[model samples]
Target: MIRFEDVSVTYDAAPGPTVQRVDLIVPEGELVLLVGPSGVGKSTLLGTVSGLVPHFTGGTLRGRVTVAGRDTRTHKPRELADVVGTVGQDPLSHFVTDTVEDELAYGMESLGLAPDVMRRRVEETLDLLGLADLRDRPIATLSGGQQQRVAIGSVLTPHPQVLVLDEPTSALDPAAAEEVLAVLQRLVHDLGTTVLMAEHRLERVVQYADQVLLLAAPGEAPVLGDPAALMARSPVFPPVVALGRIAGWSPLPLTVRDARRRAGALRERLAGAEPRRATPTEPTPAPGTGRRWAGLRRERTAEALPGVVAASVARLAVRRGRVEALRRVDLTVTPGETVALMGRNGAGKSTLLSTLVGLLEPASGTVRVGGAVPHRTSPRELIRHVGLVPQEPRDLLYADTVAAECAAADHDADAPPGTCRALVDELLPGIADDTHPRDLSEGQRLTLALAIVLTTRPPLLLLDEPTRGLDYAAKTRLVTILRGLAADGHAILLATHDVELAAEIAHRVVILADGEVVADGPTEQIVVSSPSFAPQVTKILAPQEWLTVSEVRRALDAGGGEPW
Candidate 1:
């Protein structure tokens, strides 16, 4: 349904074309998966089909692009709304209404559909996307995953033939993401709608892809072909496939089930081979000294508490008019500990977070933070101890300069001189102090916002999906910074879908289902034991003791001795 012929798009600010001479075609009713590194113009390509590139974004177009027999250059987004639907990574930015039902009906209303048709389509979309239960809830009260689904539902209500989503499930938890992917599969199979999506979480959706489009870095052409063949040859793929290829497995497995089926055959071929020696463990420091320090830190945190809880909730019953949002929920956080809140979308993860921060008032029950209740605490006073990096980074940034923005977070506080400045410098160096914050890249803006939050040195830190748009290297850096903060005894709470990150940094994991904690325990035990969670590479390869890649390498070296 979509075709790109010699498409080369160049922005005025960019020295060269963001996407150059890209010749591609998507057959009608085909599900195509687009994969590439960040900032490689993957989204730019998707914009061509939706008529957002040369139309809304204001760029120079050099080639012809058509969608459903309509030329993109001649059609605006509104004009093509009936033929094509687009959902972006950030759902909040696209919302035009306050309630879920209203948002879902927005597109149909825009198309001038009859009220009866709009009502039927809205109900059908809600059922298809599993948003019926939340149809009456406020859009701001939904979780990241639910909001994203709502965004998709809003677009799908018009019955578009083609759906183009950019990283649709990036912010969703494993189960939530699976749910969204299942809906997409149904749309393609049952509804016969064409789909073209760009995502970084390849392992999740790659197995179901009908075709794969691998975009080479800028200045090179895109590679398009079969999914399995592309995954086998592409360097950028899930680790499991990489291992399968290295082991020389024929017709390599794409999913875990496929790997399990051929595992016995693969193992038999290498049976006679010597077992590889295991990697060495990290040296244990004087055990008693480490324990003493940990004990002392805990004591210090406890003593600092003034017998008043930083955050507390009792019988917190929140409702969306009639339906319960949070049913008699109760939660608390102490002075120093990192808590990971997890659950499927619409299970009140974001609602609970918002209640604690006083953004959403509970329908019933008390919520106390540092002796003052949520509704009772003034916004200025709440800023003293609680700092939140919301799901949308753009919501928090309004300042002009990068340095000025970070400094603003501590404008009224008594932070040490140059502390905020130093924090910003550490996070994103070489970014001009005078440069506009909006002009920075997405990753750069995320870093700047994080730096701003850290400037206050709040006792409690709450981050919701902090790793949304980060690349692999950026994610690693964020892990390091968060670990450092946790070690310093900051009571950190992260609501995220990043299982690997939860395994690596969090000391504790709290699984939420139906607005309550279903499982709470140490990170290692929960992640390693839970089947739904993706096991870290170290845990999978060396299940006994290793958790990180470096640890696994060290263990292998100790067992085999240093080859070099």
Candidate 2:
């Protein structure tokens, strides 16, 4: 269905060719997963499949590319629309119509399908993607995850032969991700639709992939093979793969069920062992790097941090148009505490974050951060008490360069001039100072926004899907920074779908459903008990309380049992 013959693409401002000599064949009805670190040209490669690489993105494509036996070099995006459906990372940029129903039918209408056929396809897509109840709603009024579904539904109605999605489930909750994955599975099995996806959260999609494409680095040819064989040595992988490596399991498992079958001896070894005690301290850079940075120690203790309340909410309710996004939710977080907010898509997780940060005023009830009401506080006062890193990280960035952004942040926070710069170094190492903000990758942009927020040293920090596009190394750096903040009496709240992240850093867990808090408690008690919310390690070692691979690795290192 898709073929790339010695394809090499270069951009005007890039240091080198974004992708070099990429040759691959994606058979019909197969799901190919594209895995790589940030800024390694996954998006650039996907654009080539849709004839958007040099055609629409103003880059240079040097080799032959074909989809459905039609040469993309000669065909424009519009010409390939019937066979290729491409959904990029930013869903908000893909919309034209106002309502969900119209958006789904627009593509079919463009293809000049009969009115009756368009109507039938629209209804089928609405039910296929679980968007029936939202058909009449305005696209702009929907949450980020809801908008993502609308964007995907809009393209699926075209019945394209191949689907190319960039982080399709990044904004969704665990169950919602499962739903979308299930639909993709159906499309591949029942309809013989080919799929190509690029996702940062490997834990959610790795098991469903038919083959793996690992772009080791920029200007390097991709390695394509079986998923397990590739992930065994790949730096970027899920917790389940990590656990298999630690246990020395042959033919490593891709799913929890596969791991669980081979986990008997591994479980026995860790039965009597306990996780190591973590030494929480600030990170120091290599030899003579001059400044301290945030780095993670990985062995985060399971015990909750105790301190005074940093934020509190009582009977908070939020509404959007006719949708009650959040119910009468009551919540609280204390200093030195890290809490994770989790739920299905459009289940009110974003609404809760918006309410806490003053973006959405609750229709009823109250929200207080550091003893100050968020809705009533001035900008200066609010900056001191609370800071938020939004889902769309660009929302917090407008400066032309990284240096200017740091300088402005330092002036606003009244901190030393180099404070924000050091934080940026800690979050995203080796990023050039003179580079334009728009030129940075999605993950780097988020890191910069996070650094800006951290420079303020706000007592209450809130992040929405903070690890959306980060690789393992970058995510580890983020883990260290967040753990340092929690240790220093900063109350941190994260809204995320990455179960592995919640497993490693969060001390408490709160699950929301239909705008109401369905479950709230310690991280282990909450996540390990739920099938959908459990992390990879917890799923493999079920009936036990294990939550992360690091914990088990620590136990094994402490003489849990002999290795196989």
Candidate 3:
């Protein structure tokens, strides 16, 4: 149904083609997964399907691209709307209406469908995506994951023959992600629809793909083949595949079940050795004192109380309009601790982060950071106590160029010039200073926002969905940087749905359900018990306490031999 013939794309002032000589055919009624590292033109290649590359994005296409027998060169995005439905990484940009129901119906209305037909399709999509409860809620009031579902439902209501998605499940929780993927599976199997998806979180979707298309690097020819064959040599892959490689499996396993089937001996080898646990980087806080260490001391009068808890929330309640987003939530963080806040979509994870960062005022209860109330603290003074990297990275960026943004961060934090730039280089390398923030990919933008926040050097750091678009390599770099920060006596609280990330970095995991704390404990105890929250490694090595690939590697190295 989709064909690319000798395709190559280059921008107005680029040195070479972003995607060079990409030729492939995706059969009808099949799901094709596009896999590659960030900036290797995964998004650029997807844009060619709907004619968004050369036509809408102001680039040059060297060869022909066709979808459903129509050449994209002749058909603009609007012209192909009847057959192609595209959802980019940013769902907020895809929205046109304010309410969930209206957004879902907007696509059919644009197609000039009858009112009855549009209404029926809208209701069907709401049920399919589990958005029935949120149908009446305004899009602005919904959480990030909720917005992602709405965005997907909007495109799905039109009943197009072909669907193109970028990072479709990046924002969704484990359960919600499963629901959405099951719906896509039904579309491919029962309805004979063609799907071309690009995602960074391979663990969630690799097992479902009918075929895999790999773009190894920029200006390199693309490879299309079976999922297992390509995954064996692919540079970026999920944790399960990495574990399979480490154990030297003949055919790499793509799902947890396959890995578990082969993990018996490896688990036995690890039965005697326990995985290393994440501990506090700084000295533990005094017993029952509720006061953190004075590792990052700043002189203050008696009123300032420089030595205090990194973050303390007691009997906290927050309301958005009439909805109680958070209810009587009590939590505390000390210096040199890493805590992960996890929950399903609209379960009040983001709401809690907002309250802590002073973006939302608590309806009732107390919120103190470094002995000062966040809501009452000035923006200037709050920077000294805590820093936040919001879900939407664009919210923290305002400058026209990357260099200007870095300079702005340095000035705001009172740090020396180039401090933010250095952090950016370490997190995501090779980004030119002259590039506009809008010109960057989603992963790059998230990294830049993180670097800017790190410049402030606050005692407490808050990250919301920090790994939304990062590939495995970039995520590893991020894990290294975050670990170093924790060792330097910085308390970190990150709100994320990436279970793998939590397993790799979090010392403790706190789960919230229906705006209340459901469970909180050591990382291994909390994640290993919950089937929904466990990482691939933990699931594969069940009955064992392993949480990540690094842990298994370390155990084997210390023992000095492979199980097989």
Best by TM-score: 3
Best by lDDT: 3
**In model 2, which runs have C-alpha deviations exceeding 4 angstroms?**
276-307
Indicate the worst ten consecutive residues by lDDT in candidate 1. Answer: 278-287
Better of 1 and 3 by lDDT: 3
- Give all TM-scores, in the order shown: 0.80, 0.93, 0.96
- Give candidate 2's error at residue 75 in angstroms: 1.9
**Whole-structure CA lDDT of model 3:** 0.89
Better of 1 and 3 by TM-score: 3
- Runs of candidate 1 with Cα error greater than 4 angstroms are 112-120, 190-192, 216-219, 228-236, 239-252, 262-324, 327-336, 358-384, 401-403, 407-444, 528-531, 534-558, 561-564
Give lDDT per model, in order.
0.72, 0.84, 0.89
Q: Write the per-residue lDDT of candidate 1 for residues 338-448, one digit (tens) a residue.
A: 667776776677677777788888888898776767667887777666778887777788988876775676574545555666665655455667777765555567777
Candidate 2 total steric clashes: 2
Between candidates 2 and 3, the TM-score winner: 3
- The residue pairs found clashing in candidate 1 are 278-555, 279-555, 279-556, 280-554, 280-555
Model 3 agreement with the true structure over 1-564: per-residue lDDT tens digits: 999999999987778898998888999999999999999999999999988987889889988899999999989999999999999999999999999999999999999999999989998999999999999999999999999999999999999999999999999999999999999999999999999999999999999999999998888898999999999989999999999999999699999999899988898888899786667545232232222212222232123334546899999999999799999899998777899999999989999988888999999999999877998999999888889999899999899999999999988887778888988887888888988999899999999999999888888899999999999999988887777667657788999999999999898899999899999888889999999999999999988878999989988999997776
TM-score of 3: 0.96
Q: How close is each model in CA RMSD to the real structure? A: 6.1, 4.1, 4.1
Q: Model 3 segments beyond 4 Å from truth?
A: 281-308
> Model 2 Cα displacement at 338 (Å)?
0.2
